[model samples]
Target: MSLPPQANSTRKALVLFSGGQDSTACLAWALERYAQVETIGFDYGQRHRIELDCRQTVRRELAAQFPAWGAKLGDDHVLDLALLGQISDTALTESRAIEMQANGLPNTFVPGRNLLFLSFAATLAYRRGASVLVGGMCETDYSGYPDCRDNTLKALQVALSLGLDQSMTIETPLMFITKAQTWALTEQLGGAALNELVIEHTHTCYLGERQQRHAWGYGCGSCPACELRAQGYEGFLAQQRAGA
Candidate 1:
């Protein structure tokens, strides 16, 4: 679907952009749904920055590709959560050795980071007059962050509405979708404008390797991000073959 014009615009969305495939696709999805789409990013010292850069590429691409629409990447609304380190000992917050288990949440969990980010995003959305805040948070495909679950999202919705005294929607476009669906959505939105360019540009890896795969256009294809990405790509391929 095409993005509706501002004249008929009643809904606005603030996307939590990390510039990964999912978030970027979610941004595109928001574009199709909301008349105005704004993005907010966080530089919480998450240990990897490729994702942020990936977000930048998407913004730049939007500016270049959708110049008529004037959809530049929204402000780099990142809050430095460096202070969280003082109280956070999570693997993502500390130099602690995080071992990946076969099943269950990993050590990469950053305590209350998503909650805090959403709270900040909610406040920003209220100030911006947005009706919704879109995020790339996923449940079907995720890194085991508890906050990414469906229940957490629903609860956050309630908390934000109550705490802010305003109704703002937290939209997770990829919550039920696998990684492959995300890529396909990007492709569907702008074809080469997203799928090929995004795969090559975004930093979806947790390991944050920039030069590991120049051909693929992303990061270390061995990390958790890579695994999920690989699965998504594989699913995308399967869909292509099935023609469904």
Candidate 2:
């Protein structure tokens, strides 16, 4: 997927960055377009709490590698949604084996996670003077989280605009693109440098394993997140070889 550069660089946008691979790609996507971009994360007592640390590393590396984007990167906010974890009994928040639930969604799906993330993000954007909210949520190449659906987000956008009485836009750069395309997007946004930054700094493993590194990144290599990332990387390399 080729992401076009934004001509209107004056727009201010807030990104829902979780320090994961998709969000890292979206961050690069936003920095390329928006003039001033702020980031927000939620600490919901996730099993992969290492992502919290990865977010900081990714931010530092991005600023160091691409000073141009670093200038546009603004303040980052982390909200404590620990209550979310306390109330939910899921694979992502608790020590349990991941499997399919009776509802057909994966046990790793944290209910209302994205919805709450967006609501809080909209509130922050309201205060920060940003009219657009960016996230990496995607219905494609995902674990079938309901809140990641495009329709769900569009409806939330309408609800948020009306509730805030302010016009708001939610940007999902990875919404329609596959995981392979997302990798391609990172390269398009910042070339091989950004791709390397994502591979080295971003964290997506549900188990939070970083002891071993793969050609794609660090992960346990068997979890769903790791599986998707590895497959996407292989596809990305295949595309590169074909083009070469």
| Cα lDDT tens digits for candidate 2, 22-76 | 9999898999998999999999999999999999999999988999999999999
Clashes found in each candidate (C-alpha, N, C closer than 3 A) = 3, 0
The runs of at least 3 residues in candidate 2 whose Cα sits more than 4 Å from the true structure, single-residue gaps closed, are none
Which runs of model 1 end up more than 4 angstroms from their true locations? 1-8, 72-74, 95-98, 101-103, 214-216
As a whole number from 0 to 100, the lDDT of residue 101 in candidate 2 is: 90
For each candidate in the order shown, give its overall lDDT on alpha carbons. 0.74, 0.94
Question: Could you tell me how far off, in angstroms, the CA of residue 144 lies in candidate 1 after the best superposition?
Answer: 2.8
